[model samples]
Target: MLLVRPPGVYRAQEDTSLLRQVLRRRGRRGLVEGRSVLDIGSGTGALGIEAFRAGAADLTAIDLSRRSVLTSWLNSRLHGIPATVRRGDLFSPVNPHRFDLVLANPPYVPTADRPPSRHRMARCWDAGPDGRVLLDRICAGAPSALDEDGTLLVVQSGIAGEQATLDRCEEAGLVAETVARARIPFGPVLRARVPELRTRGLLGPDQVEEELVVIEARHG
Candidate 1:
């Protein structure tokens, strides 16, 4: 599918594809067929578009960046998928409404530098020290935003503490497990922060790649 990612909107990366792969698997099993979906951090509306293609009945998307919101909106239209795309942080834009599935490909890159990075697209991947910035928030908020049988799928880097995310999801009243995993060589962002990742012990000194994991959570 063609997605228009303008100057500032985040370009779909491996994490996005990973999340969609897991979702497609579930869809094949009839789990995502005809279900309501909420896509957090919609970026380019990729997940939202795929959700409908996988048989989702309705779609809602949220993003913090205005450029992303517009990009997602346009992409949805271009794909002929009707989606409600809004600009806001995480779940706030869709409060009180619950869905059968919640999808997220949040920023899970750990950074030594404090937040508010001046990089043009840092918002796309710069998570604080341990990389739980958005992961923790999603773990905390997703449960409440899900229907009784709702499922949450989140993709993140292993360095961001996958176990921590699972624990938080359980604490928030969900049963969580790692559904998928893949190793990717460090990208430019990660390569530049090798020293910080080493200092924080997030990776082994010689580790040249990071594992990406997709976590699945459901109401317990």
Candidate 2:
């Protein structure tokens, strides 16, 4: 489906495609058929749209940027998909409600610079120091936003500590594990952070590929 991407809205990337494929597999297994799905950080509304095509009954998409909100909303309309797209930071707009599936492709690219970056474009990819800013938040608060049988599918870079995310999810009362993974060449952001990542021991001198993992967490 064609998508509208306004300036500052994140472009769906490889990680996004990976998660969508996983969602399709889950749907084939009947896990997502007729389920309600929430797409946190719903850039371009791509994931939410996929959820509908995958047989989900409803979709609610949230994003922090107004541009992203507009772009995602427009894309949903473009595909004739119905989505309740809202402008708000992670989970805020959906308070007091829960869904069967929560999808997230949050900011996981690490940066030395303090995040929630003032630079408009950087906000889409800049996670605080260790790149756990939004990921950590999602892990901790997902349960509250999920129905009893709900599942959370989140993708993050290995450098951001995949194990850390699993542990956090487990501690939050979720049974979590790495459900999918892929090694991708460094993107422009990672390429620019080579020196900082090396210093932080997240990247080796000769390492050029970053492993991305899709973590699936279910209520324990």
Number of colliding residue pairs in each model: 0, 0
* Candidate lDDT values, in order: 0.90, 0.90
Return the TM-score for each candidate structure. 0.97, 0.97
lDDT of 2 by residue, 1-220 (tens): 5778877788888988889889889989999989999999998898999889899999999988888889889999999987899888788898989999999999887877765685678888888888999998999999999999999999888989999999999999999999999999999989988998898898999999999899999998
- Root-mean-square deviation per candidate: 1.2, 1.0
Model 1, 107-205: lDDT tens per residue?
888876687473558878888888888899999999889999999999999899989999999999999999999999999999998997898788898
Q: How accurate is candidate 2 locally (lDDT)?
A: 0.90
